[model samples]
Target: MAGPLQRVLMRSAASAMHRAKASEWHYGPGFDPQKAAAQYEALTMLVLASGAEIEWLTDADDGLADSVFTHDPSLMTDHGAIILAMGKALRRAEPGLHEAAYRRMEVPILGRIEHPGQVEGGDCVWVDSRTLAVGRGVRT
Candidate 1:
């Protein structure tokens, strides 16, 4: 028994896997682009699970350590979002930029994290619709 909706969803999943396999960038001995591309595909799985069809203001700039200075699109909830202050020095800019994107998304900012405390997207896990388990990374 296969409904059209279920069939479409299944197709989307299979296509995603195919694209991940087709990605040719590979990380090498010193540093590898292929490996990096593969990692990016893995991380995109998380983004795909958001459940909310939201838009993104991608920085696409890789100068920062995390390259996400303030792209906290995760804060876009039905109620509001709490702006996260990142712990990484290079990505401290991420929160402010996140604020701007949230503004464009028209989502309300319920609160924010102060300095001396930082959040990294790579260390965050959205376990459920309303729950998240975020970890800290080693500071340089």
Candidate 2:
């Protein structure tokens, strides 16, 4: 059997789609809020089905449209979470919001990536307990 999931972090599509056009990550012609909401609901159901305790972030009016992809702001590890400093200038506000949520949940914070070092959580992958592979690219 699969090991039990400890926790998961997710932001609502309602918050994300409200300002989709302003998002730097979306290149599509236009965003349909209804479709986004449906997709988000489906994804949440899947996470719940996997038996992970989900933490939903409802504060969406921060003008961070890309917030729905929570994987970009922080990376979780066995030791703790590393709050990333996103390479995208528009996304700089994300990590602080995630940090507050983590603090509320009592999740330990290992450290944070400072200004000079730009690291998006989406660019880093944990190969194993002692190995982490990070991509060095425009968005990393």
Candidate 3:
């Protein structure tokens, strides 16, 4: 059975979420900023939500040592790998690190995309063997 306090908490949480608008709620239930993050961190909600894993600006490895434009491989093949040069300065070093790793593995270089056209790693997705899409996510 649901307790009275649990019912009240549900109502309060619902009200807070409703008032903030569906897409506009960065803060969580209680409508308080300080504790808002805590409600959002609850396990029940996160498990049900769609996760977007972005290693970008990874606190540990920002991929700076690699290159400013590094991205995941197009395809991880047994023979070797393909390194892509990103269009943006924000990712200039990532590809180089990937290149070094491939070098250690004794893989061959497949060629890269040069400047003028900018691409963000966030905008990349592997569609299939014949297709790889690169979208400029933060394009102005």
Q: RMSD of each candidate?
A: 9.5, 2.4, 15.0
**Which regions of candidate 3 deviate over 4 angstroms?**
1-80, 87-90
Deviation from native of the Cα of residue 14 in model 1, angstroms: 24
Misplaced by over 4 Å in model 2 are: 1-4, 22-25
Residues 27-117 of candidate 3 have per-residue lDDT tens digits of: 2333553244355346325433534221222223332322212333222333445555454354456555556655755667665555554
Query: Can you write out model 1's per-residue Cα lDDT over 9-28, one digit (the tens) per residue?
Result: 11122222222322222212
Residue 48 CA displacement from its true place in model 3, Å: 24
Estimated TM-score for each candidate: 0.50, 0.89, 0.39
Ranking by TM-score: 2, 1, 3
- Cα lDDT of all candidates, in order? 0.46, 0.82, 0.40
Per-residue alpha-carbon lDDT of model 2 for 7-108, expressed as tens digits? 889989887766667346654756677788798899999999988899977665777777888989998888678999988887899898889998998989
Candidates sorted by lDDT, descending order? 2, 1, 3
Q: Count residue pairs with overlapping backbones in model 1.
A: 14
Candidate 1's displacement at residue 107, Å, is: 0.9
Decoy 3 TM-score against native: 0.39
